[model samples]
Target: MTSLTLAGIRKRFGKVDVIRGVDLRVADGEFVVFVGPSGCGKSTLLRMIAGLEDISEGELRIGDRIVNEVQPAKRGVAMVFQSYALYPHLTVRDNMGFGLKVRGVPPHERRQRVEAAAATLKLDALLQRFPRELSGGQRQRVAIGRAIVGEPDVFLFDEPLSNLDAELRVHMRSEIASLHKRLGNTMIYVTHDQIEAMTLADKIVVLRDGQVEQVGTPRQLYERPGNLFVAQFIGSPKMNILPIEAVAGKLPGQPKTASLVGVRPEDLELTEPGSGFVDARILISEYTGASSLLHVQLPSGQVFLVAHDGEAPPADTSVGLAVEPGRLHFFADSGRRAD
Candidate 1:
């Protein structure tokens, strides 16, 4: 296992800067995930760490060595990409042992390593099958097994589950989590899916337009986001942002510089009409088996979502929305959180 450090990392495509001055420290055996929307540079940063892209400036260290100039194969890291990238003509055993074969490892040792990895990935039964004969999940496991045989210090994944179906993705997520637990190797995963980040990471790194938005545990980012972008991006149904005046008198010790207040969908509760701080008319009530998402439009024309259990009120019905003062998140004019 190895720890990774990025100091003032920057990446540029000619005159355009894609990754700007990122600094991070990943501890040994840590499962760290990078999450962001498309074009946010999450993948670019991962590529840099994998030595697949040139770092315009900054230092990258893996363990105790400075690996900024090292070749990908010598960097002590293995990368699993979105595509399985398996050879159609090669059997599972050959594919898993290909790296070892190329490095001139002895035949007996290669067999032992390949068999061990196959057993670990539950691919022992498929060793004689070709890539075309395996299912999507099986193929992915082969790709991961190939990496495992290399005995890399760190494992890097770039949306490795994106191509799988929804059900398969969930299954693979658990498989990867279990693999991490068993291997205890440092892992860096890049994904646009927050759910994946939330479910699999020991720590989460949120990025936006080549900059680090925030870095914390999944619960930290969800329960106490550092800024408006994080508050809106981390949660499902997203946090609703309203002008401060909407709940000006309802909150205690409201900061004078607060321009926007945020309340998560789950934090907003339905109350008796005229009994809560904000009054709104229900625009739509979307019933999702376990809970209903109520889209309510405030008098100021802004729509907010509230998660409700049991039956929902009919559309066009006026209702009151209440939120605990402690649950409200305040943001300054610049979008940074305000105390």
Candidate 2:
């Protein structure tokens, strides 16, 4: 296992600055995830660590060695891509062993290692099946098995389940989480899916544009985001953003401007029209399998979502939304978090 450190890492393409001075330290055997919207440079930063992309500035160290100039193959990192990247004609056994074969390992040793990885990934029964013959989850398992066979210091996954169907993606996510537990190796995953990030990561780095917005554990990022971007980005149904003037009380810090309040859907409690923080008209109610989501419009014409029970609030129902102060997030006009 290895720890990864990236300091002031920056990358650009001609006029477009992709990654802007990202500083991060990933501990040994930690599962770190980089999560952000598309074009936020999460994947580019991962590529830089893999030696697939050059670091325009700053240093990248694997364990104690500075490896900014190391070749991709020599970096002791294996990346599993979203596309699976499996050979259509190769059986699962051959695909898993191909890397070992190319590295000039003996056939018997290669077979042993391949079988071991297959057993761990539960792909033993599908060893002779071609990629075309396997399900999406099975194919992804094959891809992971290929990476596991390399016994690399770090495993990099770039949205490996994005191509799979919804159910398969969920199954594959558990498979990956379990695989990490069994291997206990350092891993870095990149995805725009916040659910995956929240579920898989021991630590999460939230990026916006090209900068690091916040880095913390799943609970920290969820419970206490550092800025407006992070508060809004990390949650599933997205946090409710209310205008500063809508709420009456002043926050702890006296600031240059009034603060906008953010509350997660789960933090909101619907109450009688006059009992809660603000009165809003419920515009729409959507019932998801687990819970209901209410889209409400405040008196100031600002709209935000709130989590509700599957019971609809009645069409055009007016309700008061109350939130616990401990669950509240305050952001200044500049979009930075306010204490």
User: Which candidate's lDDT is highest?
Assistant: 1
List the global CA lDDT of all models: 0.95, 0.90
- After superposing candidate 2 on the true structure, give the runs of residues whose Cα lies further than 4 Å from its correct spot: 250-258
**lDDT (Cα, 0-100) at 311 in candidate 2:** 81
Query: What local lDDT score does residue 55 receive in model 1, on the 0 to 100 scale?
Result: 97
- Candidate 1 lDDT score relative to the true structure: 0.95
Per-residue lDDT for 187 in model 1?
98
lDDT of 1 by residue, 48-68 (tens): 999999999999999999999
In model 1, the runs with Cα more than 4 Å from the true position are: none
Candidate 1: residue pairs that collide: none
State TM-scores per candidate. Answer: 0.98, 0.96
